[model samples]
Target: MSTISVREFSYNPSAVFARVEKGEAVQVTRHGNVIAILLPGSGPVARYADLVAQGKIRLKAATSADRARLPHYEVPADVSPLDLLLAEREEDDR
Candidate 1:
């Protein structure tokens, strides 16, 4: 792990970028207050797979119709699927 002031990161971004490229985490501070972190993103699926491989999490498989038609559960016919889809799309863009 490494710590760098926001000023240092701003003045010489390559140095912080190099540390991130090496898979080292970094903490960035502004006015002595922790503001952000820098890390390499290798994609969510691969990272999730690695976590499952390391037993950090458990995996599950669900059958079709288990959702929207489970015995005690159901999706209302009038449910607004479009609204949910739009929200998810906005989150993905973020």
Candidate 2:
């Protein structure tokens, strides 16, 4: 981990980002007080995998039985979904 003042970080953000990209954690300080930490991002896929590993999320695909269990609504071919949503919102406001 490395510490840098906020002014130093603001002057050359790309350089600090480069260091983080190379997997170095950086601590940003404001008035000698720690404000933020910049660390390498694992990206969306890695984050999702981590969530799955921690049992925080399930990635189960819906089966035909599951689909049939859900409530069904018939939408008019001429009506826009957005218009329906707006109309629902207007109803809620009343």
Candidate 3:
């Protein structure tokens, strides 16, 4: 494990990331207090675990009833949903 100040990490983030990529864990400190830890991710599962740990995302086990409760939309066979979304966004911007 390696410790570095936030300013040092910010000035050269790629170097810190390179260290992490080489299997080193880094602790970032602000004013002598540890603020964040950088770790090498294994894959998507590790990414999701990090998000969950950081309170950025919540995971729930959805039951069949929960799936049934979700609203379903019907689009015309010839219509593009992306077009509809863009049109709605355009209206919102005005």
Candidate 4:
């Protein structure tokens, strides 16, 4: 950091600002006490209004867990649902 009295700012401000651009912070003093700091400006300020222009904020992906809760048709190993029903109806006819 560089040290420059407040009196020097009146003659040349560009020199003081050059120090700030080089990442050197300055302590502006008055009456030998630190009054304020002269440093480079930070980036733009962020606010809530910036989010309105963007889409929904989501971070999760769709899962297949819901499909597992459904009921399934059960039949013998040698017979499908249609074959079991047809066999029952044929027996009922006799």
Candidate 5:
């Protein structure tokens, strides 16, 4: 972990990011108070994976039975969705 002032981080963001890309964490400070942390990653998706690996994030697993029981969109084969909408519009007009 390393500390970088906000002004320094802002003035040379690429250099700060370069350090992070090397798997180093950087702490940004404003008025000597820590404000943010920059971690090594290409983007949020990669950061999320890193967080998960670090145990900083936890995810719930869905069971096969739970997935099977989930509701699915079932459009009736005999009726067009446009027909239903038109019928509803007609009812509303009346």
Candidate 6:
């Protein structure tokens, strides 16, 4: 498996897909944190356990029910997520 930053994935998605097409696994990271994995669907699904053991992919953290549940956030309609995040950072700095 190969690791790629989010920026690199964004810069060339086709290239990443090409790697998977060649039966290579790809791990996508953000800020040095693993966020997702791209696996070749044509590969045997049974080998997923082996991949997980090898740390090629993180185990599922959420169940189907968790995914089906909608998350509701109470925020002003005009507040941008970036602004909210920045405000939280400012508060942390204090």
- Among the numbered candidates, top lDDT falls to 6
Which 10 consecutive residues of model 4 have the lowest summed lDDT?
Answer: 44-53
TM match of model 1 to true structure: 0.43
Q: Which window of 10 residues has the lowest lDDT sum in candidate 3?
A: 55-64
* Residue 26 Cα positional deviation in candidate 2, in Å, after optimal superposition: 0.3
Clashing pairs in 3: none
lDDT of 6: 0.75
Each model's TM-score? 0.43, 0.45, 0.46, 0.40, 0.44, 0.49
Error of 1 at 61 (Å): 35
Worst 10 residues of 1 by lDDT: 58-67
lDDT tens readout by residue for model 3, 1-94: 5789999999999999997786555778999997887766764234665775585864454445866997575779999988887887899999
Report the C-alpha lDDT of model 2 over 1-94, residue by residue, as the tens digit.
5789999999999999997786555668999996876656764233455554465764444445865897565679998877887887899999
| Prediction 2 TM-score vs. true | 0.45
lDDT of candidate 1 over 1-94, digit per residue (tens): 3678988999999988886675555668998875766655553233555564455764343234544475342447787777766776899999
User: Pairs clashing in candidate 4?
Assistant: none
The predicted structure with the larger lDDT, 1 or 6, is 6
By TM-score, rank the candidates, best first.
Answer: 6, 3, 2, 5, 1, 4
Q: After superposing candidate 5 on the true structure, give the runs of residues whose Cα lies further than 4 Å from its correct spot.
A: 42-94
Give per-model CA RMSD.
Answer: 16.6, 15.8, 13.4, 25.4, 14.8, 14.8
Model 1 per-residue lDDT at 66: 40
Q: Candidate 6's residue-wise lDDT over 1-94, tens digit each?
A: 6789999999999999997786666779999998887877676433685676577766444344755795555678988977887887899999
What ranges in model 4 sit over 4 Å off? 42-94
Off by over 4 Å in 2: 43-94
Score candidate 5 by TM-score against the native.
Answer: 0.44
Q: Across residues 1-94, which tens digit of lDDT does each residue of candidate 5 receive?
A: 5788999988999998887786666778999986776666764334555665565764344345856997565469998877877887899999
